[model samples]
Target: MKTIPTLSLALIGALSLSACQDKTAAPEDIRPVRYAVAGGNAETGGARYAGEIRARNETQLAFRVGGKVVAKLVNSGEHVKKGQPLARLDPSDYQLDLAAKQAQLAAAQSDLAQQQLNLKRYHELLAKQFISQAQVDAQQNGVNAAQAKANQARAVLDASRNQTGYATLTADADGVVSQMQAEPGLVVAAGQPVARLSQDGAREVAIQVPENALEAVRAASSLRVTLWKGGAPLPGKLRELAADADPATRTYPARIALPGDSHGLQLGMTADVALPAQASRQLSLPLTAILDLQGKHYVWVVDDKTLRVSRKAVEVGAIDSDNAAIASGVRAGDKIVTAGVHLLHEQQRVKLLGQ
Candidate 1:
């Protein structure tokens, strides 16, 4: 019985030693890290900018002659074709002036015929020496004077006819009548604007960019334009940059050309333009890897030897789709925390979840 008890005690001690050894040898539990993965790739920066849709060509239609507007053939928002009649002035005054000129021209023609006959008679008499040379010379002078008067009268007649034609206003090109400045019975001055015509053709988007961003705008390759109705994004090429900044707002204007048929687009419609930001080869990482604290952006980077994490400040450039482009602070080859960045703090020790 004594030997059995001693053997039992020895067995219990060995088991207790084994249990302690097992406890010491066991591996520590590693917390699983949840992360989102993003690949570094070429991406375009998207920015929403307000813009205006404008016609490629717009012209002011005016009258050539001043008169009472007798009739207005077109109204605002009306489409007009080339050579279409837009408005007409009172033709009564112009018609009377033309008729009077015609009458004067007829009288001048009759006088010219009579003068030619008198000149013929005078030359015949001078050759025969039947009449005095002084008398023949006087008749020739009268004939010359009559001919000059006839010519002047004919010129006057033609001018009156031309004035008559100027009473009507016509469109010089195909366009839509955007504005009407004249109404019936309205007396307008010569060369006064009668209507505003917008030519049917290409469309452009005008955007105002900050003066400080002018340098980046000049370096950008292209811009993105979006239509308001469908929110459709279309590629637009940079066409022109304003020479001077706006005095009131301190912004530079930029014009971009939108491709495709512009017939459906109305003048003065609003557009959204995305201007390219400064080009930079940034360290792009997943959005989940970025942590926002105290209104500042930061990220977690891993230490290679110790497998620890440290928070670092980053200047973000553009959010390309889902990835954040890091302008500064992080390098290309740095091991960034793909997941579990929210759970990390400055100089926090960490173990690779999988490794």
Candidate 2:
């Protein structure tokens, strides 16, 4: 009787232990996942683009006359004032040309004086009946020819002097020499670029946009420009955009004009521009939260009360690298599974993490 009672107790205990194990194992099938509340308001569409700081006005300075670059007065990156001499040409040739012109003018003036004296003598002779009218007329014509030659030589001399002045390259505006193309001993022609001047004040940024995004970029409501070195964001406005795409880059070039005091900005400094997209306000979610099935997009949204997930169809708009712009079907404040979404099903029981 004692053995029978002990055996019965052991069997009952085993049955009770199995029952407890079954109770604990039943809930293990419910998977735990990380969930985030989709409670953010529709974000303003925006994108970032890389660009470089530039001057609002850039000028290429060159010499007006052709000559050997005998002297480079300013180095690259040197600041210059308006009318400052930037470079000089070999003035030896110009001086010689000027001397020749002056000599021609002087000779012509002397000839004119001689012709006037001859004309006076011929008139006297003609008055005395010593010379023919044709002879006096020839003297008058000689005087006129000498006078015209003198005037022509004088004009040529003036042009030669101007050319001499042009031998010295001067800055047309107050700016910094951003580049130098000619050095000492290099002969450059007239209108050949010798230096690049970046005009002072009113800086801008040069950026390029792809064909697909060019229109949106141009239509941005506002722009914020930030330097790569990091500083307070600077306000910028679109000054102009390229009419056609660049052949090599196939991108439209753009310029953003910066206003106010941009103290720390410098030429050629890399920058980033933020432009708001003109598209309508839309909700954006992580790309991983989206699931594709049979060509349709779906997302796992959880009920706030039951913690059960349901598959909801979503109208996807723009798909960026990391996020998808949801156009419809998913409302704000809905709990969505960002990770491990593919493993979930409709009405599937799930344990919420970070509750």
The TM-scores of all predictions, comma-separated, are: 0.62, 0.76
Candidate 1 runs further than 4 Å off: 1-48, 132-145, 242-254, 281-355
lDDT of 2: 0.86
lDDT of 1 at 274: 74
- RMSD from true fold, candidate 1: 11.0
Highest lDDT against the true fold, candidate: 2
Q: Could you give candidate 2's per-residue lDDT for residues 226-312 as a string of tens digits?
A: 899988888888889999999999989999999876567788999999886444566778888889999999989888788788999
Q: Write the per-residue lDDT of candidate 1 for residues 256-328, one digit (tens) a residue.
A: 8888898678888888887765445676777777888888888877777876678889887667456788888
Worst 10 contiguous positions by lDDT, candidate 1: 30-39
- Candidate 1 backbone overlaps, count: 1
Candidate 2 vs. true structure, TM-score: 0.76
